[model samples]
Target: MEYSFRIQLVAIVSLMLVFPNTQGWGEDGHTIVCSIAQARLSNTAAEKVKELLPPGNDLASMCSWADHVKFYLPWSSALHYIDTPDNLCTYQYERDCKDQNGEKGRCVAGAINNYTTQLLNHGTDNSYNLTQALMFLAHFMGDIHQPLHVGFTSDRGGNSINVHWYTRKQNLHHCWDANIIETAEERFYDSNIDEFIDAIQQNITKTWSSQVEGWETCNSNETTCPDIYASEDIKAACQWAYKGVSDGSVLEDDYFLSRLPIVNLRLAQGGVRLAATLNRIFG
Candidate 1:
């Protein structure tokens, strides 16, 4: 509307074109996470979510809304991931939660906290946009679980490291972001995203049943524990994502088969934790 706002929007759109690798998990990954979460939500939280979402849209359908709006909301770009110190394989909110400009609380973990805090105002005298808050909280929960989202600062979380995912050439970040999930969907699920999600859901109920509660619990009555999730992410980044792969490495069957389980686990954790956090918030 305003002339200055229009100029700012154009500038941010330019940045989006220049830095396309800042995204979190791909569309299917996000949808899988949100679908799991929405199914697990308490009645109160689910109804609140329904009220907040746009008409005819569910949480899973809007899970990627945060990613889509980055062009106009430039400040949100940095909030999609954290850049920890190179070779550390550890994440500390104070040290690693800043943006490239070194602004604290600008990373994915902080984004979750900030949005969760905003959503806590639901059913009361609310000021912040709870719809955006819900979408961001749901989205960042998935991002924090993405191992590479809390990856080394030197490589921009593997975005700069070129690699070949099987045959096609792409970056390490893109592999973790979309390629791996897409490949898994195509090869294993007949390219059906819903089938991929159903398989993960089945694992959550049976294979991972005992561990789900532990993943959902937070110490000291916290609504969310992103610090714990971020810590796990960096460790996974070291142990699984960047372990044997070098720049220009070819990620083939061995890499994909081994890493798909970790991806599945992270998606499950992201979904379970998101539902747990929202339940705590809206309960």
Candidate 2:
């Protein structure tokens, strides 16, 4: 019995070693998206958001609230992502977004649709519902853009792929979500999240102004477009994010420097598109 216990304990510790981290692109990434959206929101949209949030809490503060509650609300966990089939390597709504139970159109993209409708039409239904929609939208918007969140089923969105960031061991998913972005901030932005995001917003506004319409138009007021949008992420993850990653691979400066643009571009797109959604719903 003692030997069996030791074996179980070792397995638990080994799993924990690799899985130790928060879900989704770390809090900083989500907050950066929300904050940029807040900055870009029209006066009316900003006012509406301020009215929805709890007193003293802003959009950025509750950006990760969905992840926090997914423990108890297990039904919503799969709403964070849609897994493209391993061989498929693409996000087809009819193919991928049947939820974990195979229920059609109930993935993160679906969640965005439902929550957006709720906020747009029934935002005043009650405080609880209003808050739920706002939190879901804020979090899901960021999730759909993380690239890995729209990643593969075979490896559990890169979670199953063991990797090392330089010398520290971690999985590909967490590395993209947390480590890479964290390291990017430290190296390029002096670890200043605000300054980095602000500069990203400015650069996006100046350099990608025309592209905003293309991206924002990719998502309509309806939910049908989120699938199309998520496909963009899945394709990106396949061609860019998992490019060189392999079992026991050590990723260093080249990987980080090359992928920072993707991280920044996705962040920029998320913020701008979020602002567009809010403006339409509240305008």
Candidate 3:
């Protein structure tokens, strides 16, 4: 009887370990890390973006460009968590420990460094290299815009904070990543990317200069930049934390209303800024 009980116990333990529930692993808000990349190519924008490609015998370039952009989507989203050392993978976590300078140690900053080096290596004949550069520029700009990506060391940017979202057990980190954006996306325009972008661009164009300044100011304190997390109250954070949010809460229906507008304005700034960087590099 004792031997049979031991065998059963071992089997149960193995089963539990193998089939551990992952539903709650990332249930809070979206990380804002990988989601930034998803914003790049909506189903609506794919055809439009393809239309912008150069003509005649450039099939390889076009395909390469598409793949390059797609590749960065995951990185763009993942890079948001780079600043938070605790949230990083074990390998990255150890690497961060070696850097005494806080900013230099940050994953996002490291990604920036890596990206710069990659951008400077001019030997590659990959036709999609330019697109890769542009996509990186766009996605990184958005990543930095999200404050939660620059989270604290203690809580791993709210990853440890147990919370509830509409009766379902959740955490703070996943909430920002999905609930907020998903809510907004569903509530706002008919899930149209171009329209979303147009609306967001129109809304932020007049004040984008100030918005950039605000992000710069928030990021000025290197020690604090990586320690902050988005607030529990998504509506309030959108309203108070960012310059564009006038009301305390953004209605679910109105979420996409501002997304593309914001993306468009950011892209415009990124393109111009990227051009300036290139001019300096090649001048």
Which candidate number maximizes lDDT? 1
Once fitted onto the true fold, the runs of candidate 3 whose alpha carbons sit more than 4 angstroms away are 1-106, 123-138, 209-283
lDDT of candidate 3 over 1-283, digit per residue (tens) = 4345345434543453344222111211112222222233444333333332232312122221212222324433344444334433222344442232444433544444444455555346343243344334333433433444445455554556565544556555554444444454455656453454444445434656466434323244331121221221122223322323222233232443444343344334332333333322223
Better of 1 and 2 by TM-score: 1
Summarize candidate 1's per-residue lDDT along 9-68 as a digit string, tens digits: 445435544554346798888998999999999999898889777667788987877787
- Name the runs in model 1 displaced over 4 angstroms: 1-22
Clashes of 2: 0
Q: State the local distance difference test value for candidate 2.
A: 0.80
lDDT of all predictions: 0.88, 0.80, 0.37
Winner by TM-score: 1
Where model 2 places Cα greater than 4 Å from the true spot, the runs are: 1-21, 123-128, 218-224
Give per-model TM-scores: 0.92, 0.88, 0.43
In model 3, where is the ten-residue run with the lowest total lDDT?
22-31
Rank candidates by TM-score, best first: 1, 2, 3
